[model samples]
Target: MRKSQIRNPKHRTENCPLSPRLNYFRIFLTFARNSIVRDMTFRANFLIDCLSTITWSLMDLGFYIFVVFRQTSQIGRDTGWGEWEFYTFLATTKLINGLVQAFFMPNCEEVSELVRSGNFDFALLKPIDTQFLVSLRKIDWPALSHIGVGGILLSISLWHITQREIDPAQLTLLTGVAYIFYILCGVAILYSLMISLAATSIWLGRNESLYDFWFYITNFSRYPMEIYSGDVGTPLRWICTFIIPVLIVVNVPARILAQPLAAETPEARFLLFFTPAAAVACLAISRWVFYRALRSYRSASS
Candidate 1:
């Protein structure tokens, strides 16, 4: 009994303590929940924003459907999408897009502003990790709704993906893992991209066009890269895949579920294999850029 107690206590003590990463996550969750409560205090604005988001999602779909219908009437074929496959692709992309904009971009923008204003000093003074704090400092309540909306749309899209070149079981597991990786890599690439931009704010003072430029570059990912045409399209597609890579996050993942060109084709399989690699590579470059930018950080007010 005594030996058992000693061994059990040792095991319990080891198991009871949280890992350093888990502790950090716990801290983040606590901070996020606190932020949410604070934001909730202004309930009117939160609900209004949430309602606006829902309206935006619905309207976006309505507009797409209307355009596709008109085009089909004139040129025939449903939006070049083939079947339900295209509809859910758009739906999932929309949801993911909203979540990224509402949550990730806002925080990054806020960081740039704070850095520009020299308020980043206050942030650095906080006890927690500066990156963690900056990343989760704010929560847009409306963006949470996008999570639910995207999930529902994705669920609906699953049926269509099934009817396509692949069946449910295979596509679901592959796409599921891919989606998780996409979000992580997407966020990493985004952070890498935005950190460099924020670093620029330290010098450029006003890059009003930066965000717009980023968006313009990313817009291509919403549709098939094939639409870009050849030769020149090849390089442009490379840029979208390896340089910016936002296109792969949405377009490639969606395509995976929507259908395969013919996995049997060498071109299709190569592109499929390359998609995640390209995203990871872009993120890695962004990280290096961010580190370089930090070295050049002039601090606010020079």
Candidate 2:
């Protein structure tokens, strides 16, 4: 019996390394480095997407500027922002959106699909934690155009506001803080949302709606959420806030700039609390759902 037990592989250690969380971060960083190289190999794609990025940014600025001119006098009453103010708001939002699209969302799609194809079994069999590999598989560097367009627009907007020399350090402080928290919440919300959807792939046999869902969610963040102001309707605001939750991810930093240079507003301070908390809960719930859904998966055809 002892010899048989020694020969048997059934009791061997499972292949997984550290828990999912740590492994996810590790693979994510390595994947980032590789993606930069991959994207460079396709220079034409990068140039084309870069032009699109700048064009889209210009269009966004044009839309807001047109609105500003239409209501030049009654501006702040609506967005609490004037022409320059609105430009500033959009510049930041654009930058954040660019980063999210370029880096985060693409990878989320890869993971969720892996689960749906019954390919998840191969991932589970790897010697590394599955979640880590799943999250960091694909990256798009062309999205970096949003960052450049954002900088140019922001500088132009700031120049309009100051009408004098502006300091880079001051600009950096706000953009830096906003970008950090914005990406964190973005990653959190996207992963949670994708996981939730992907979990259903096990039962539904396809998450075809995922692309649509991602497009809708990102659209909110593309514009300044403050425009959704006023009574915020009630039902509309409820949908925007609870269902999509893009406001916290995209608008908070712009909120910082929307107020006066030295704002004392309580709502503007550390305002991402709700979004991050929700992301955590959503991701957790999705993880649990994954295991439950996996049990029901019958491989391929629904």
How far out, in Å, is residue 67 in model 1? 1.9
lDDT comparing candidate 2 with the true structure: 0.63
The C-alpha lDDT values of all candidates are 0.62, 0.63
**Candidate 1 per-residue lDDT over residues 1-302, each given as its tens digit:** 23333222233334547765676678777867876897789999888887887787778767666777456532223324544566666765666676666556666677667766778767654544455566666667677777667777777767655655644324647667766665555555555666566556656655656678667765776665555557898788777776666666665556565654433367657766776676567666755554455444555744
Error of 1 at 41 (Å): 1.0
Query: Candidate 2 has which clashing residue pairs, if any?
Result: 24-132
For model 2 the local lDDT of residue 263 reads: 35
Q: Per-residue lDDT for 53 in model 1?
A: 77
At residue 181, candidate 1 shows an lDDT of: 67
In candidate 2, what are the lDDT values of residues 181-226, reduced to their tens digit? 7556756666666656656766766677777876776676655554
